[model samples]
Target chain A: MAITLTRTRRKKIHAIFVYLFLIVSSAATVLPLLWMISTSLKSGDIIFQIPPKWIPNDFHWENYYRAVTDIPFFLYLKNTVLITFFRVFAEVFMSAFVAYGFARFHFPGKNIWFLILLSTIMLPGEVTMIPVFLMFSELGWINTFKPLIVPAFFGGQAVFVFLLRQYFLTIPRELEEAALMDGASRFQIFYKIFLPLSKPALITIGIFSFQGSWNDLLGPLMYLNDSNKFTLQLGLAMFNGMTKVEWGPLMAASILVLLPTLIIFFAMQKYFVEGISVTGIKG
Target chain B: MKKLKKYEGFLFISPWILGFFIFTVFPISFAFYIGFTDWNSFTEPKFIGFDNYIHLFKDDNFLNSLKVTVVYAIFAIPLGIISSLTIAVIVNMKVKGIYFFRTALYLPAVVSGVSIALLWRWILDPDYGLINLILSYIGISGPNWLGDPSWVLPSYVMMAIWGAGGGMLTYLAGLQEISRSLYESAEIDGANGWVKFRHITLPMLTPVIFYNLVMGIIGAFRKFNDAYIIGGAGNQGQFYMVYLYENAFTYYKMGYATAMAWVLFLIILLLTLLVFKTSPLWVFYSGEVEGTKNKPNR
Candidate 1:
């Protein structure tokens, strides 16, 4: 009885240490973000105060207002949304279509083609970046949204295809077999059976593509030279490059830009986590 | 019609096939050809057989950037793996509110790229930056982080560690996949936490570690956005990708930049291949272990 009691006490003590460790580490993890929020609300004078204040005496909401006006925030937001929408639509539909082909069929050279597709994942984009930019320039697509949106319609990312294909393979063949027996076309089977049935997989890939298209910087930076065509990432980079950096408004702008991704992540936290694990394990 | 039926799969994947040729094959071939020439965007192509590649070996900027990137990768990859694995183990504990901690830790990774770079610029500010402010309270003066050449690599490493929680979900998944039966058997044999962790958890987590290692190598080499935004003193922060970008855009040395990109690709390939070759020694697959059990003890 005495030994069991001592063991239980030890376990309780261990639990306390574990909780304390988690609390302290998580606080550390979130410190910089919290500081950004606090700094965003502080007036210009207090932003760089000697002993930096965690909570300012006066909250300056004008910083967010300035962040919008100073950088053409709404225009950039629209541009970003436009590109993201097209890319998301393309990636969600096209990637799954390609994945379904790989999952369902066994044509000659299919394995070779699939291997090439898989190999492209390891091929760094930088190798193709310069030439592709020149190719777009030759086609008079530079400084437009075409370069950003067009490629996504083709196959999207190979990673997205691979994920969807893995998901598609797990779906039972019996359903497709039954549909075929009823004289349904392959296209009809794909549309009626596979598409609706793979909602979770589709949703996961959709979220991934949405995040990728939204957060992309290099794509916009390389393709779009016009201020009007600037995505939010390019706009933010331009804002940061200004001669005199306004710490307060900049932080506010940063917060606003990051808000969408944060909301998506928190709201769809399960899919995000699951998607990552899937990629990590399988890739 | 009968022959066409065998090729029906091509219809579904035709988009990828078209993209593969136009986007992948064509650009890569063009890039390779361009690397053998001196073609500024405005000028006619002048063939320069391997001059750019040869010059890169002796180029101070190329050498410095390569050295800086290699050094950063050396420290950051190991540190990142350790921190992330540690966070995963902690978060994997069957404690209440652990999900909240997981979410909080992962929050930064989701808010990556430009915002992260801008935020870190303030956090590492020498004067009134968060690090200095905190340091002053403890009577320990912090060095000029981004401004000091010596401190620049460490600053980037710090940022890498800060985002280490980005990889935590993978390790968590790996941890969860580990069979409870293995731990139960270890417990029955009177093993302590450290012993169980050393014998079971570490081996089981190797595949996850291996995956992260490959990714970490690629990420460290391809780092550009933050390096471009928050530059270090004396060009110490001019990572390989940043230099490649500058060469292409700022200098308009398209051919030379293409050569650099090729070189970067080769380096990554070699490193990744090296890891794969060495993986068999350390990475333990459960199926392979079962096969080995049938053989006599070495």
Candidate 2:
């Protein structure tokens, strides 16, 4: 009876321990973000106070207003939206088309082209930075959105193509075959059938592309010289350095810059999870 | 009918093919050609065979950048894999509110890189930072994480772990695919939990492990934004890519930078091939039939 009692108590202790660990780790994961919000609302002096306060006495709402008007925030926002929209559209459409070809066709050099595409996935964008920059420069595309948006249209992102191809392969061939027998053209079948079914994969690619282009500072910083052409990320960096690094405004701008990606992430959370699960199964 | 269908397929795929040729194939071939020549923005190309490659071997900053990159990859990849797997395993338990826990863990990954990095910069501020305050409770003085070269990579490692939600999600999916029947059988055989996990879970997870390893290595090699933002100009945190950027834009050493680019390409290619070569020994495909001459099932 004593042994049984001890065993039950030990199990209870272990359960409690596991719960404690989960809670602590989750808190640690979330604390930085919570603190960021808290600090952003605090006044400058209160932000750097020793023994940090959890909440501010006064909510400085003006910082957000200041973050916008201080820079050409509207211009930067417009550029980010424009570039991200085009980039995501191109990446999803082009990658889907290419992925379909890879999935369905048995043409000559198919394996080689597929290998080439995969190889490009391993090639670091940084390594290709200089030569690509020079190429864009030669084309007089510097200071424009061309360098950022054009390559995306070409299925430059091999990972997205690879992912879409994997998803497409899993789709039953009978669907395409049925469409074919109905006198439907390949394009019509792709548009009417494959695309509608691949909405999850497309959404996944769209979110990924949007997050990438929206937050990309390096590409815009590298290719665009004029401040007017700056994306939200580059604009945020400029905000950081404009004389006195105003923590409140900086944090506010950071949050604003982060909002779109966060909204998209939550909105399409299901598809994103599904897409990753599909990829993970193969991996 | 088949011949015309094939023609339709070709027409459907023409946009990608044309774009591939004009953008990818052309630029890639052009990049290689540029690497072999000394062409400034204004001047015509003067073929300077092997000069840029030779120069790269002697560059100290380039060598340091390589060392930093390797160090970062070594730390981040293994640590990220372990932490992510551990979280996935824990969350896979038949616990209440498991979905909430998963979402909470994954929230960081969805947060923008710039925001997270900025948050960390504040958190690791040495004096007034929350991390230091937490460490103070334990009577340990925390170093200036991002400012100090010794702690810079480790700080980034911490940041990487915070964003390990993506890998954790992948691992969770992999864990779910694991057969519950195997666990039941192991229990029936009087095998302990640890033994069952070691023999069953670990072996079954090898394919997912291999996938994460490849992705993590590639990602670590391409570490940019975090390091770039943290280190900035005049800081030793300038990663290999950052140095490549500086050379290309700051110093206008386009040819030299291009050569460095090729070297990076080779390194990544070799690493990928190495992973593939070793994958067959460990990566178990569920559909792979034994003792057959047929190609392994997709």
Q: What TM-score fits each model?
A: 0.96, 0.92
How far out, in Å, is residue A265 in model 1?
1.5
- Model 2 TM-score is 0.92
True contacts kept of 2: 0.42
The candidate maximizing TM-score is: 1
Which candidate comes out best when scored by DockQ? Answer: 1
Candidate 1 per-residue lDDT, tens place, B32-133, comes to: 999998988888889999999998999999999999999999999999999999999989999999888988887766788788899999999999788888
CAPRI grade, predicted model 2: medium
How far in Å is the alpha carbon of A196 misplaced in model 2?
Answer: 1.7
Candidate 2 lDDT by residue in tens digits, B104-215: 8877777866666677777788887878988988999998887677888788788878877656866777778777777888899988768987987887677778888888
CA deviation > 4 Å runs, candidate 2: A1-11, A105-109, A173-182, A278-283, B1-4, B232-234, B280-282, B286-298
Which stretches in model 1 have alpha-carbon errors above 4 Å?
A: A273-283, B290-298
Across all candidates, what is each one's fraction of true contacts kept?
0.73, 0.42
